[model samples]
Target: MRRVVLRGFSTEGGPRPDRTALLSLGLVVLFAPLAALSLLPLLWPLRLAGVPLSLGYTVWACSAGLYGLRPVQLALARLLWPVRRPTAAERERLDLVWSRVLRRAAVSERRFRIWVVDLADVNAHCVGRDLICVTTGALAELGDRELAGVLAHELGHHLRMHTAAAAFLVWVLLPLQALALLGSGLALPFARLGRHLRRTERGFGARRWALIAAGRLEAGLRLAFAAPGVVAFAVKNAAGREAEYQVDAYAVDLGFGAELLSALRWFEACAAPAAVAPLVPGPRRARHAAAREARPTHPPLERRMAAIIARLDAAPAAVPPQGRGRGRSESSRTLLP
Candidate 1:
């Protein structure tokens, strides 16, 4: 039942750090390119028709196109994820929490539509421009403040257009994934052939040498096809880690740093031990395990917590005013007037 208080480091009365400036920088770097890419398919016809579009015009067209897809994306999300409508009691709680969060963040209440899934995992994510999905386990486990923190973290993703960016990037990377799949398919026959040769080769003679050569050929082919995708995957995950940090900073700016940190700790505790276990005893085993853990799409929880704490320490203490319904009695601040 301990509370985490964020302390400010500025003592000289220097100018407060600009949250707007930071948000703007994140938008330009993280959202702009993805917005442009999402527009590309829609604008292709204009370029094909020889409309002579400028770069600025093209970007405008793309933004419009991406905006148009929001409804369709929301529909697809509902179909794929299949969340149930909130019951009367659940709806009341959701409305209270969401309204307070929107008021605190100064965002329009209509901008986001919240969905609760029947999943058991304590997870939540922003699906599209407006769709915020949370698992039932999250609702059951998190207090009102913790739930608000989780929502704020997801809201950060929405505000920065990270979901759109991710969707666009996935489209861009589809071909690379396909190539990797194709390579695996192609290598399967060669691998089978090598295995067959090894099985038929009865002794250490010409047949054994031929079997070794076949195995080598199979390995080479697999590497040739899989290497590009392997590199791309690594790069994509690296970018994803940075994006996670950016959104964490956004949540802290929303005055939910302590809650989010606590939520993350809960997640770490819930995760399987092997998922976060230290490297194995041997030197090589430990080294390889370390590399595998480092390759995940999000940075490790310890690193993320450290980064958020550092950012909070440097951030101005009074940027976002605390919301009215942030305590155990938050349900009293319902949207029902």
Candidate 2:
């Protein structure tokens, strides 16, 4: 068995970028120009203020979380997403768990920030490289050890730079994603308009037909151009499944395998009844059309649990979390305040 190191920690040299991280970055490079098109409007105001700008630099800056703009990133996440700074009670609970996690990982508390996402589901996620968002439900629902496992899993993503690559990737694709959203929003309205015009014109107008043909041709061409990037994104998401397993391994290495395993079982218990509960009568396809077992970025639950169990079973008895206490290594504390 490979000996575990708490300080650096990982599959290899101290959680460097893996294949998933690189692929996310590769997609960013491929889509940078197209994404730049979406940022022009936002930058126009700055240009009016005589700020020097280049599309290349602006694209890079945004993808890199605008470099030194951590405050802006946090603010945008609060405004646009279901996240916020933790309240006193939430922070008290959150920090207690986080201190243990940080203590185990041998990392400074100041390096990472945690946020509370006001959600009911027992869940959490890593955003970019520095932010960890935990759902309020998770705080209320999980025990301290269970919550630590979740945090450790997310911290693994940061250690490997997975979140860094992913956040920037999403930002890079924002323009295309926004366009896709816009098209869907306009689709029904345009269809209604077309039907209305068809009814008024008694169904045959050369100009209308010409307009429809032009629109279809333009849409087809755009789709054709977008196909490659879409394929790349799918590949990146596929890579994300492997990352889930890798971080699971990280949690295990930190002696939180049992804790993480318990957390997973807790989730399974909560979700079991819902998975099998009766739904409205419908065709099999229709009933399952909207249901999903897991996200594209996660491995199946059974597989993740199995992986964690195997790691825990194989872990050496001398490992801190296995048979030893948190004080197994005094070195972990040497770096802490």
Candidate 3:
């Protein structure tokens, strides 16, 4: 029955689904706190036994709950994360571009707002509501029309409510990172014991290993206290990737998927080689590095470009009206897939 409901929810298009948003919020409300509570168990033994509760675990739990709040905060921040201390002129420029994009898109307040940051990274993102973020590097590298293509893609995310879902997952992921660090050496043993205990508790062997792992990890003393958090995080991130694809479909629907793909290829071809691991020394640092390598705010350019190409080919075209003069010529040029 639950699977059926989720399957129905996955059939997305048209205006946004209120039930889906509520369902997601419900899950965050129901599970995030429980996941946070489970973190306490990982440290139970530390208080009773000699081992201390790694600071990472505490931070992880807090982050899980905090994740529920980020979309709202991010909406409030409004293109603030990658930027710091914008000069008056810089702010004005961002405003001009943002206003132009919003006006062109005909986006309503219910849809999203465009925000530009000063970061050098070539990335753009949108969280819940109409809050969209584009970096300085992204704006500088791409032409105005090409950048509009990027903005269109981000608007696709807003149309899909990807931000709301992402907000709920952030905190849950933090604890998982802590778990990966804490259970590095003992992960296997704790997983084995956790599985057996779960099977025994249910009176029959049920295949809910993931939940069991989370429960064990939260239980604090289960030896693999961080196991559930790590496992759950991976699952969530995988889901996050799927959401990106859905947004890609929306981008195509908005008449810019192909252009977005070309832009992505251009970005990837020019980007500096990003390191796979962090050089920082700390418990959570390794997990941070791993996550960065996994998804540096957005998926790798190659994969994203390929996905966009695939989506564009799979769907019918919906080209927007070309601008006047030389810019129109550039837009008309066929970009090789």
Per-model TM-score, in order, reads 0.66, 0.67, 0.57
- Candidate 2 per-residue lDDT, tens place, 209-231, comes to 85576557556655654554465
TM-score for model 2? 0.67
Number of the top-ranking candidate, with lDDT as the measure: 2
Best by TM-score: 2
Candidate 1 differs from the real structure by a C-alpha RMSD in angstroms, to one decimal, of 10.8
Q: How far is each candidate from the true structure, as Cα RMSD in Å?
A: 10.8, 10.0, 11.5
Count the clashes in each prediction.
1, 0, 16
Summarize candidate 3's per-residue lDDT along 1-337 as a digit string, tens digits. Answer: 1110011122234336343344455556655655666566566776678655666465654554553354655644543365333457645655654555455455653345555666666667665454566666665666555565667666655555666665665545554556556655455566666667766565334546554765666455433555566455445555555555555555555565655555554555556665663221122211110012336234544555555655555442343222212234355543333
lDDT (Cα, 0-100) at 292 in candidate 3: 22
lDDT by residue (1-337, candidate 1, tens digit) is 2222322221222122233324333434554454445445445678888865476455554643563376676665666565666777667887887776677677878777888777666667767567787777777766676677778777766776666555555444444455556667777887887788877888899888888877887788777766654665565555555556666776777777766765665555554433443211111111010011343455666677666667667442322322223253244322111
List candidate 3 stretches off by more than 4 Å. Answer: 1-36, 39-106, 109-111, 173-223, 277-300, 314-337
Deviation (Å) of 230 in candidate 3: 1.2
Alpha carbon lDDT of each predicted model:
0.58, 0.63, 0.51
